[model samples]
Target: MEWSVTNLACRRGQLRILEGVTFEVAAGEALILRGPNGAGKTTLLRCLAGLTPPLEGQINAPEDTIAYAAHADGLKAQLSVAENLAFWAAVFESDRAHAVETAIATFDLETLRDRRAGALSAGQKRRLSLARMVVTGRPIWVMDEPTVSLDVENVARFARAVEAHLARGGSALIATHIDLGLPTARVLDISPFTKLSGRQTDDPFEEAFE
Candidate 1:
């Protein structure tokens, strides 16, 4: 499905962080969000994923269609690498064997299959978290800084996965500060949409009158 956002306004605790944001990602395409810290990249991704609501405007996509990967690795520390993927596969109602195997191979987690999540390094945990997104088989990926702790080789693997997903008519909305090596992907910088001074000028004339 094609994802579209129109005049989106996102807020954090009554603080308007982003406004007048608009974009679209058609099936088989990827859109990258580029901006510095506190530019509402994460907030925008969360709003798209339905973890939070947009303060205004509309998102023309269903929440269930999105597979969101936040900065934090949302893995069960006690579970083994394979077990983590297996658990998510079951949750997503996918074929446990196939999904788990695909995820492990895609993220190069085969050797760490038996290792507990807590035992893995920072990069390993991030890899597992990314693999979970793959197991869900969701059409739209809303990832926030997906390459946080990944090395160069693993990042390449992630790029391949994204390309393969798009090749299969899937779409992605990624928020990252680094280059994801996706040449064809469109870029959206969130800085322009950020609200300054925690206030919005609803009416230019009103401010003058005041």
Candidate 2:
């Protein structure tokens, strides 16, 4: 599936988070949304996922075709790893035994399948949230800081999972300060679009603290 955002703008209360943001993404292509804090990366991702609507613009996407993994792990924490996958499998897609098992193994969660999500460490919870994407099997993924708390090994694993998804013709829009190893990604810097006049600048992060 193909997704497009044209002159998208969003506001939270009186604050304008994003404005005049335009971009397009197609299957097998990934775009990295990069910028300093408060650059609206997560806000833009939320707009694309339909969690929040844009003030003035157009987003062409399939209904619920996008899977979103926010900064919060979004896991029940009370539910076991297997149970969490089961619940999402039932909610987002069909309740298929094989699919859940495949996702568990794909994210390397088999060892902690029966463990409660709350019992898992920060990194494992991130992995569990990512595994939800595998269960949904959707064409578009909007992930916000997906690699947070992950170590070197799991970060590599997450990169491989992204590669496999892209190889299978899926599209992704990832908002991150850390790299996800995308070699051919087009970078979109949303900092310039901020409505905060004092901070507006042509360069993505010029004068912005690193």
Candidate 3:
């Protein structure tokens, strides 16, 4: 699926944080968001994912086409890796066992599939969170720092997973500071849009990522 954001203006509470933000992500492509912390990258992504309303502009995406992966893992601590993936697969109304099995294989979580989410290492937990994106079966993926705790090897695995996604005509909009081995991805810096207030906001929502 293809989606776009045009001339977006957004706010966090009463604070106007960004304006004139624009970008498009197409099937089999990735749009990489690059900007300093507190520059409203998270805020912009939140709006695009429909978690919050934008102050102005347009988003051209079909309802329920996007799957969001937040900075936090958003996993159940007591659930095992396979169980966590299964839970999300059910939530997204995708094929249950098939999606869960594919996610474990794609993320190399088979060995840890039965381990409790909270018991996994940091990188392992991150992998499980990312695997949830796979189980969603949504065409578009909107991720916020999806690789935070991953090491080099796992990062490579993640890159391959994304490659496979794009190969299947899936699109991704990701916010990250480090390179994820995506040479075809384009970078969009949101810094200038922070000029709405001539400075980043002190709003806790923006402060969290800063």
Candidate 4:
């Protein structure tokens, strides 16, 4: 599936952070997002993921094909690693016989499959969160800083999983500072579309108003 965006303008409350953004990610492709802090990289990804509505423009991806992974790893603290993946698989109706198992193996979580999310170290939780993406079986992945708590080795493992997804005609749009080692990935700098109206303060939530 090809994901396309055109003239996307977005805001956090009344403050416009970005405007005139346009991009496309074709099947088997990856698009990396780059921008200075407060340039609306996360805001743009949220709009693409449909977590936030754009003030203007068109998103041409299929409604249910997008799977989003945000900066916050939204794991249920009480759920075991396996249980968490199972829950997401059910949520996305990904009834592929081995969906949950596949995800566990993909992220090397087999060792911790029975561990509660609250008990895993930061990197382990991050792996589980990304593993949730695979269980969803969505064609397009929209991730913001997905490598946050991962070590170099884990990051490479994550990159391999992404490569496998792309090999299956999946696409990804990611906002990250570190290189994911995706050889064919293209980068799009969002600074050109940034609007300073919401960047005056250092707080990311400051855009809620002025």
Candidate 5:
């Protein structure tokens, strides 16, 4: 899959989040979106994921070809780990048992498989959310702050999983302050575009702070 954005912009109230964020990601390639807090990284990711519309410009991709994982785990706080996965799988019409099993093993959630999602710690919850994405197995992954609150060991596992995904010809666009441990990944900074008015300005995000 290939994703292309030209002059893409987003706004939050009167604040300009992303502007002219022209970029592209092809299959098996990883692109990192790096910037400070409130630099429009999350907004850009949301736009790319089609969860939120870009006020101006365009973001083009295949239908149902993208999977998005935001900073929030997006888990139903009331459900058990297994129940949550099962629910999502059924909702998405995915292979429930296989998806849940793989996610449990990948995130080391075997012990917590039957535990309630609300009872898991922050890191565990994040792992659960990430595992949901892995199970979905979409071609393009757009993640915002995927490594947040993860310990060193979990972070290493997360990076390896990402490598494995790329090896399989999948693509990812990640926004994070942490390093993703990919040698060929390119980092783009969206800070320069923050000055643009509204979310639709024509200032393309700069390539910086790799």
Candidate 6:
């Protein structure tokens, strides 16, 4: 599948944060978003994920094909790691047993499968949160700061998971400040699209790739 955004504009409340943002990610590819804080990376991802509507322009991707993972680890604190993934698999109407088992092993959560989410450490919780994304079977993963609390080892694990996903013809749009170790992923810096005080630029991409 190919994800394309053309002449995209995004806003937060009354303020417009980005405009004329355009990009495309083909199947088996990844795009890494980079920019200073408040540059609309999250807003753009939210717009693509259909969590927030674009202020203007079009996103050519089906809603059901995208899986979004935001900064918050959307996990029920009382639920066990395995239980959380199992619940998501069932919700997505996928192969619940296979999804749960695959996700557990993907994130190295097997040992912590029976432990409650609240009892896990920050890294563990982040891992579990990422595991949930796998159960959806959605091709496009929209992730925002996915490695928040992860250590070096866990970061590598996450990178491998992303690579494996791409190898399976899946695509991802990741917004993060740190390097994800994906050498082949294209970079989209959101600085040019950031809204300025008092006036909006007529052309946001004139210097976009510079």
Q: Write the per-residue lDDT of candidate 4 for residues 1-210, one digit (tens) a residue.
A: 787999989886557888899888999999999988778888888877787789999988878999999888999999999999998999999974499999989999999999999999999999999999999999999999999989999999999999999999999998888999999999999999988564345565645321
Q: Give the clashing residue pairs of candidate 6, or none.
A: none
Off by over 4 Å in 5: 196-210
lDDT digits (tens) for residues 1-210 of candidate 2:
678889999754445677898889988888988888877777788778887778899888878789999877889979999999988888887556876897898889989999999999999999999999988878898898899999989988988888888889998898888777778777888888877433344564332222
RMSD of each: 6.5, 5.2, 1.9, 2.5, 5.2, 5.6
Q: What do the candidate models score in CA lDDT, each in turn?
A: 0.87, 0.83, 0.88, 0.89, 0.80, 0.88
Question: What is the C-alpha lDDT profile of model 1 across 1-210, one tens digit per residue?
Answer: 688999999875546788999988999999999888778888788788787789899999875798999877999999999999999999989899999999999889999999999999999999999999889989999998899889999899999999989998999998877888998999988889988446555665323210
RMSD of 2: 5.2
Ranking by TM-score: 3, 4, 6, 1, 2, 5
Candidate 3 colliding pairs = none
Worst 10 residues of 1 by lDDT: 201-210
Which regions of candidate 6 deviate over 4 angstroms?
A: 196-210
Kindly list the per-residue Cα lDDT of model 3 for residues 141-179, writing each as its tens digit.
889988899999998899899989998999998899989
lDDT value for model 4: 0.89
Poorest 10 consecutive residues by lDDT, candidate 2: 201-210
lDDT of 1: 0.87
Model 3 alpha-carbon miss at residue 197, Å: 3.4
Cα-based lDDT at residue 30, candidate 5: 90
What TM-score fits each model? 0.91, 0.90, 0.94, 0.94, 0.88, 0.92
Residue 27 shift from truth in candidate 5, angstroms: 0.7
Put down candidate 5 lDDT per residue, 1-210, tens digits, no spaces: 667888887765445666777888887889988777767777777777776678899877878878899767999988999889888777767888997887788788899988999999999999999988777868788888898879999998888878878888898888877876788888887787765353433444422211
- After aligning candidate 6 to the native by TM-score, how far in Å is the CA of 71 from where it should be? 0.5
Which residue pairs in model 1 clash with each other? Answer: none
lDDT of 6: 0.88
Instruction: Give the distance in Å from residue 194's predicted Cα in candidate 3 to where it truly belongs.
Output: 1.8
